[model samples]
Target chain A: MTTLPTPGAVRLGLVIDLDICVGCHACAVNCKEWNTGGNAGPLSDYQPYEAQPDGVWFNRVHSYEVGDGPAGQTVHFPRSCLHCDNAECVTVCPTGASLKRAEDGIVLINEDVCIGCKLCSWACPYGAREFDEDVGVMRKCTLCVDRIYDEARPEAERVPACVSTCPASARHFGDLGDPASDVSRMVADREGMALMPELGYRPTNRYLPPRAKGSGCSAHAKSPALEPVMPEGTGFLGWLDRLLSA
Target chain B: MHPALSVILFTVASGIGYGMLMLLALFLPLAAGPADRLFGAVSLGLALACIGGGLLSSTAHLGRPERAWRAFTQWRSSWLSREGVLAVLSLVAIALLTLAWPILAAPVECIEMTAAIAGLLSAATVAATAMIYRSLKPIARWHNRWTVPCYLTIALASGGLWLDWAGAATGVDFLPRAVAPILVLLAAVVKALYWRHTDGLKSATTIGTATGLGALGQVRPLDPPHTAANYIMKEMGFRIARKHAAKLRRIAGGLGVLAPLLLVIAGGMVPALDRSAVLLAAPVATIGVLVERWLFFAEAQHVAMLYYKADAV
Candidate 1:
């Protein structure tokens, strides 16, 4: 069961468009608000109001300055449990608390069976799982299992908190098993990529390639609808960019 | 990554135990002294204590202590299981040799040969323990020929220290003052090689490869798919303080290798200095090795670290 599942088969996944994301951090805040109030109560912050804030969070957004000069800029990366098919965390667990659901291909933790050893935390490379110090157990993103299947919630908003709250429509969720599903289609059209696939984790979530800032001919980059030739770079924007670089 | 005190104690204590016993066994090839029996017995006892206490301490890290025995059954494939098996085998070999001490002292070459065989078994068992780490291919730092030799050296060094201390207590010269320099030199070379090998390694995963788009010029994490820190980050994403690591490296090098080497050289040179000086250096060198081992683990960056953008960290 721990063997990695085939790509675009039994598992459902998400394809997030990073190019359109406004870095509002709505996904992270909504995720915390929903999960803490749902099945897993209180994500347990260890000094919420202090200078050094630390606690168990199922999702985290890291803002980074990736490059330098005119071609480089800031990028916001949000992290969550990958729900990997290989799932090393499951095998490393002394208890059977860590498991991947066969029915939905979603990895989950049974809080009751967990003993707070934190071995699964080490086995994972993604930094996805968080230890609930108060309860003495590991907690992670369940891909909003409770919300997605909740009969009480509206069917239209049944997706994960991060997916539903994306004001820029950057996040998409559907069955990756169906090649025609929204997620699958987006991956094919936008050239989506798996995070750390070489580790053989086979994570369910996919990250759509960041769109190139300018028009380019490479398949990985976005091609402009119509090509234009700039006249000796005389624009004010180009002048400012040159000045900044100088 | 969590740095559990019990595990640290378990590994360090057990590493010392097996390492000492292995060394004593190696010394058997040099000469079998009258006090060798006493040395063997004390070292065996300490090794057993370490193994037993270590197993108990390791249980503190398990979710279900009751399932600990299940690990032993998986030795056919698991390094963890092999480690357990080797620990038991070493214990058994020590027991067999201890029982045959009378036969060994009977002034018969045959009896001495049998006792020597037992010593070989003990050494072999400790070597097997070292191989457990060496066998893990996923852990690039652990999978190497040097790992076993380093472990053997540490074991011998620890045992020699014990024997020297015991001999000093009973007015016997178990470890000659001349032997310390050689031990320090060997240990230093091994440590240096391990550091050099691990330092020059490449990141296991690149941003381009991670996303399965090998042909892509460059791929950076734009919007990470989630909001919270999950299991992977808590475990494999651990990072150490660079400033403290640099300081500790100097401390470990000085104490574990350099100072010990100087002490041994000084002990060998100065006839006026008592054997106690050689004996004193053992504990000092051990404290140094312990700090060195701590840094070894703390400084090791797992291949999985690339997923967390640790290159930037």
Candidate 2:
């Protein structure tokens, strides 16, 4: 169905721990390797081993300088399709090529019907969608759709290529819709958050915020445990407390 | 946001085409012109060609033009689909009016009905085209209140300039000539307001907010994800230099608004040059709208840019 699934549906997604990620881009590389040969195979590269090598990548890792002065930190951010509940990419499609699976909440494009309008790319705030120049169609993260459901593969290996390949074990894949799920528990514990919440895409994917660095926060600098003095209802600890109690 | 030539031409041409068709629809039914077979054929034929050619030009940019028919099936959700459906329907309605023009000796009741339908459909299609851009919340410049009004007025202004000439050629010049200048002025005012409104605004999404790291003092892109420019950057990171945009905006205003307004007024005041002045104004106004249309895409800052080096999208 093109419309969003009701809340509390099986919203399968990722939880990336920013603190642990080393910015190695192993996930990105492995993603390209596995997906290029998978269902959405032969991900096009325009000029490989040439002046400017360009291709379609479902995942990208960016490094950012967070905070300021000595308190500032370098944070590695791996971006991909968040599989937003209100997936703008799906609705903007003139052809019914882009669809969000009502059962699992995975946003997908039926390439056969795809006219390659590229409007889906624009609708995505995360820059997740990539247009294949060679194929002349849009390609994006399928959340390792082919491998995820394959009963033949070993249970451990059934996870997404990115999650399975993360060197630091920073990336995770599970049902985020269930608070009891491992990924959802990780979100509650680490105070993971979505990117650009103001836009209201309601992305299922969560990013575990990087810990405080330098002299940014005295409480964080001292220890991960114990509370800093903030309002009773504020900060991650308070949020976690509320989640745990509820 | 890359300003593809095909899209620029499509918007400019179709905009004017629809504009002219709308005016012709009303004028034909009301007997604004002689309603002779030759004048009907030439005027309606010219309008249809512009609209048809412009619509065809749009398909050239599609990655898979062969599957464009599938675009019509999703009008329930997509504005582009709605536009596709409307464009074809308006074409059929206009084509009917065009066919009726040369064949029918007298004004038929069916002609009046068809013209009304054509006019509404043409107006709706043009509005839908504007909505295609205006509905995109990621593009702050396009999603604003000013976009639709700017599109509608500009279309009328540019299309009416030629309609004035056609009216004069068919022995009824006064009405179109008078109205074209007013439309030009209204379009100019709207265009100016749109520019002014967007100038002070910044894309709501910032790099910090995009990364969900704003609360962490300051944030900046340290290492880009890839060495090569990705699809997002290539497509959405298009930035025009300030001077160039300013210069083009002036050119658009001069040719599209001021020139057309003056020429149409001149066509009215100077009876000798009359229709010729209006004729000269049409292409000038179209080129102006063409440039403006290009700027529409070029100036739009996509929200995705916040992840890349953009401080604000």
Candidate 3:
């Protein structure tokens, strides 16, 4: 039951663009919001209103400074379940509850069948799986299965909540299994890379690396930095600003 | 990585159980007379009790203990499932062997054959348990070449100690006194070698490689996704100080290895202390193995922790 589907089966996953991701938690927040009341409802929050606020989040956006000082790039990396072609999380489920869909290759946990041994969580190298203490089951990104296939929802709205809500248009979702698919073409054009490919999870998701300096046609002609309001100490505030900038 | 009591107990206790079961099966053929049935009852009772207790404790940590039955279905793909299936099969074989404890009057061939099969099954069950950890690629400490050997040797040493103790008390040769010491030495050596090999070994995964951004430069987390510790952090991010781990290893070695070895050697030297020393060795070695089990989990660095600000896994 944990065996992956046919190799060419539609692999539904995300393509996150690192170039434009603004370190916004919108996707993660939207994911939690929709999923809290969606297929996996009431995503447990241990201490939402207290000094320590923790909850189950399907997506988590991490910001990293690659390099040091001014030369460094602030890359916003969003991590979640990749629904890999060779998902150890699915295979490691002792009760056969974690499985990759044969049709679309979306990995899912059959909560009813899950014994909640948490071995699946241990098996997952990505740290994608989260144990729901409230329900006594593991939870992860469902890819909005309920919304994606719902005929009642609009075509555009049928996408995953994270993809739908990304303000910077950094997230894209489609079937990567199809060579002719838009997602696949995007991968080719951008030279999108897989995270930790050496681990051999065969993660379905791709990440478009930040475009090289002076490579992609940028909106701004020069680096975005604040210039002194007045030339060379026309005001005390201006002088201070120039001094700080130096 | 969390070092949950349930898992530690399950491995240590069941290892002892399976080890004892296998030894008893092997020893049955060496029996001379009516003493066989009494030995069978006592050894089987102890082995079964340990196995049953350990199995039940494993379920204590499960989120849904009621659905644990379904775990047997995925033996084809899951090591955990295979462990479940094999543990049950081993129990059946041991039960049958115990119920139909070989009669001295009965033909020798059939009894020995069944005993061998039960012994093999018990060994296989222990292997499956080790594999549950060994197969995990993310936890480098568990997935290595040392894990299986460590488990097997530890089981044999612990179980052998018990058998030797039982045999001494009952004046039966369940396992040769010489054999238990050899196993104890082997276990001690293997454990020392494993520790030596793993000491200061850096994980292949690092923050830079994890994000696939090592080409750019060193990748350091500017901001974590959450301020509070999440489930992943709490589970996989367990940190044990070097000093703390070193002290525990010494404790485990002293109790599990040195104590048994010394007790056996001393008992051999002083025949007067032989019976009492063997009796004390079993419980003491079990506690040592328990401490060793705790250190096993505490020291393991899961690859998933790399993404959560761990410089390396």
Worst 10 residues of 1 chain B by lDDT: B102-111
Clash pairs (backbone) in predicted model 3: none
Residues B1-313 of candidate 1: C-alpha lDDT, one tens digit per residue: 3345566666666666665555555555466445355655655666667667876887786655565664454354434555666666666765665565533443434335545555566566557656655653335566666777776676566556655655655565655654545666776788778878866766556644543433434435555443444444445544563338778878877877777667666766785554666567767877877776666556655544454563532
DockQ of 3: 0.70
lDDT of 3 at A60: 89
Query: Which 10 consecutive positions of candidate 1 chain A have the poorest summed lDDT?
Result: A1-10
Model 3: per-residue Cα lDDT over B1-313, one tens digit each: 8899999999999988888877766776776643356566667677888898999999998999998999999998999999999999988887776666633423555556666777889899899999989998888888888889999999988889988766766776667678888988999999998898887576667776678777778888889899989999988988853349989999999999999989998989999998889999989999999999999998887888888775646
TM-scores, all candidates, are 0.73, 0.92, 0.92
Q: Residue B229 lDDT in model 3? A: 91
Model 2, runs deviating above 4 Å: A1-8, A214-246, B32-34, B168-174, B241-243
Give interface RMSD, per candidate: 5.3, 1.1, 1.0
Tens digit of lDDT per residue, candidate 2, span B1-313?
A: 8887888888888888788877766665666444667665766777788888887899887889899899998888788999999999999988887777666744566676777788889899999999888888778888889999988888887778767666667765434346788888889999999999998886557887788888876888899998989899989988763339999998988888888777767766889876677678888888888889989998888888888885645
Q: Which lDDT tens digits does candidate 3 get at residues A1-246? A: 876567656888899999989988999999999999987787999879999898788898888888764457889999999888999998888888999998898889898898889998998888899998888899999999988999998898889999999999999999998879989999999988887787788999999988865432344546687875657655788789778989
Q: Backbone clashes per model, in order?
A: 22, 0, 0
The full ranking of all candidates by lDDT, starting with the best, is 3, 2, 1
lDDT (0-100) at residue A30 of candidate 3? 93
Give per-residue lDDT, candidate 2, residue A24: 99
